[model samples]
Target: MAMSPEQPSAPRRSRIALWLVLLLLLALGGYAGWHQWRAREQAVVNSTQQQVDALSERLNAMRTEQRAQARRLQQADSLNRVLRDELDGITQRAALLETSVERLADPDRHGAQALRLDETEMLLTIGSQRLQIAGDLDGARRAYALAAGVLDGIDDPAYLSLRQTLLQERTALDALGADPRVRAIAQLDAYTQTVTAPAGREERARDERAPWWQRAFGNLLQVQPTDRAVAVQAADRAAALAGLQLEISLARAAAERRDTAGYRDALRRADTWLQRLAPDSAARTQQRAQLQALAALPLSLSVPTLGSTLQQLRQLRAR
Candidate 1:
């Protein structure tokens, strides 16, 4: 039997309703997908902002560190200037001391001992001033120690002893701190004993066998010279030694401060001095030995004062 038109139309309407429902569902799904995509995009933007902030902070930290390093370099330069000025003053004082010592040894100067004592006193005063200027407690203490030693060696009973017997006196004077008094006294006693004692057996034997007139001439020429060449050579040697001493002091200061450039410059100067002082092969070998000794020392050793520096320099030359 053939179906009625009404029945067929009803089936078609039901199919249309199903199609409408499917279309609605598809629209809802599209909206949900779009919302999810927008949320993901927002999350990506937030992450990017956080990364940018972190980079900016890192850049700022680097800049701050750079500025701090620059400041430290400037401080190092200032320290160098102070050191140079102190060294210049010390050099001047050393020259004066050398002249005084030379004069005191002269036979023509009858009151040479008294003059030497006075010169020693002056040197002590100058050393005190330099220590104050340097602003280094260790240096000041060393200078005071040296001064005390010189004072103790004075044979004159009137200046035999200091008013400040105890370490308290040094503290009151503000010349040297209290800690170095015992050490200074000990050093002074040792130095005095050595200076007053006679020559060693070897030295005495060498002196007895040595040519009298030639040796006398050499000794006299050191202070009272008739020959120009001998005097010139002696003067040149003294000058060179003085320069080497200065270089050694500078190197010591550089090492103490941990300034690589300053240390290198001082080392080069020391090497140059060694080269200049060594005229012959034997002397060169001797100088090389001295240089090696110095090189072997750690680069961080402290040199407190000019006197200490001079002592070290003498040790190097003796080697």
Candidate 2:
């Protein structure tokens, strides 16, 4: 009834074969799991790289925007400086004009002359500034026209004035360049050369004689038409005095009549005179005092009484 040795060996061999098959199946399963894990890790690495690239792109864009903003700030600062300088220049010119106006109120001849000169200078400055502004504005307009594909109207008054001013400036420059004195000064060396030449003495002697017309006129034009000048000067002086006197008289009459409009007009005229007087003249001081006194006078005075008072004052001043 005991089992044979061969039968025991056969059972052991079958158990070994079964163990080998199980080992092979376990090895295949481990290899598949390792492959799947490696694939998942690679996918995660790719996703991380994509995120990093996106972040880099965003950072570059932000840097570009910052640079643009910085440039804009610089341009704005430059423009602000230009505007400030221009405004300062304008303010200085305006202050000078106001000072000149204050000078005009004086009644003295010196003050009047100074005021006239100041006014003339101011007018010239205004014309020059207008010309400059017109040129700059025209340039701006041209640029706009180019951009917008349209031309501005040439018939505009400002445009016409600008053109006229440009023409005048050019003509003035040409005239200055062609002046005899300027030409002579510029050609001094040439003149010297000619004068030193052996054949120059006779020509120089002939040039010394006065022209026939000049000899005949006997310096008539050189006398400056003194009679006419004197008459015109007298007329101008009378007109200026009369204008101030008339305003004062009007103010007095308005006071008598209690007419506010007339009083206001007289005050305005006085103010205008003050503005037209020279700053350093004695006449301006007198005018200022007169204006103050007139302003202080009662607006509702009795006509007869005011007339009597004015007449008495005039008589006293004359005496």
Candidate 3:
């Protein structure tokens, strides 16, 4: 077993070579694992960097949009302020114009002459309305008189001609005569009385001496001179009389309103009722003539120079 030291050194050399080969294999494996880990770490870093860059870009875009919206809002606010200023200016100008107009129309600036002129104009206008609208002749005359008195208080030479015109208008108004309605109403009353009065003894005697055939048929029929048959029943006569009274009342109302056409039409209807109420005779004809006269009466005055004074006054005021 102790044969030679050379044999022992040879075995030792073989063992050392085997140990070196195992060390070399371990180093190569460690190097490969480190390289693979480094590659994986580098890929993760690159992916994380890409995500951060995308987030930064989006943040920049948001900032830009926010700035643009802020600028637009500022512009809108400026426009609103400008519009408000313009509206305020317009309101101020309108108020100034109204104040100026009111100052111009103020009556205190013109003294007594202006007051008189204003009164005259108002009275004249009142008179015109009363005459034309309400058919108030007395009221119109009173207004005209007061207007004349007020106008007389004005000593201005320029208004002298206005007085003359006013006088002329008043004169024309006076010349229209009495109210036709009054005369018409009187005539109607007389007509009603004459028609409604009971017949005299002579008429009763004539009826008693009538022919036998006429007397027999008298209760059934009454032949008028116009060849119209009339009913003899008391109820029918009463009904006709009531209709006549109604028509007369209508005519009277129309006259009060100064409705000329309506007045005439009502009178004509009343005449028709009268024909039924009264038998045809000289008295009936006379009654019809009177009714026609009343129907022809004028309810309103036609004065062409009615508002001449007012027109002249306005012209002077304008000057």
Clash statistics: count for each candidate: 0, 12, 0
Which model scores highest in TM-score? 3
Best by lDDT: 3
Local distance difference test, candidate 2: 0.49
Summarize candidate 3's per-residue lDDT along 1-319 as a digit string, tens digits: 5775555578898999999998899899899999999999999999999999999999999999999999999999999999999999999999998876775677744556776788999999999999888777788999999999998888777778888999999999898766566767777677666655543343456668989998788778865556664434556767777887888889888877778898899989988877876567897798789889889977776889988999999998877
Worst 10 residues of 2 by lDDT: 301-310
lDDT of 1 by residue, 8-97 (tens): 578798999999999999999999999999999999999999999999999999999999999999999999999999999999999999
Candidate 3, residue 82: Cα displacement in angstroms equals: 17
Deviation (Å) of 262 in candidate 3: 2.6
**What shift in Å separates residue 166 of candidate 1 from its native position after superposition?**
49
lDDT of 2 by residue, 50-134 (tens): 9999999999999999999999999999999999999999999999988666656645324544533334334334433432443
Error of 1 at 29 (Å): 1.8
TM-score of each: 0.31, 0.34, 0.60
Candidate 2 error regions (>4 Å): 1-10, 106-112, 115-319
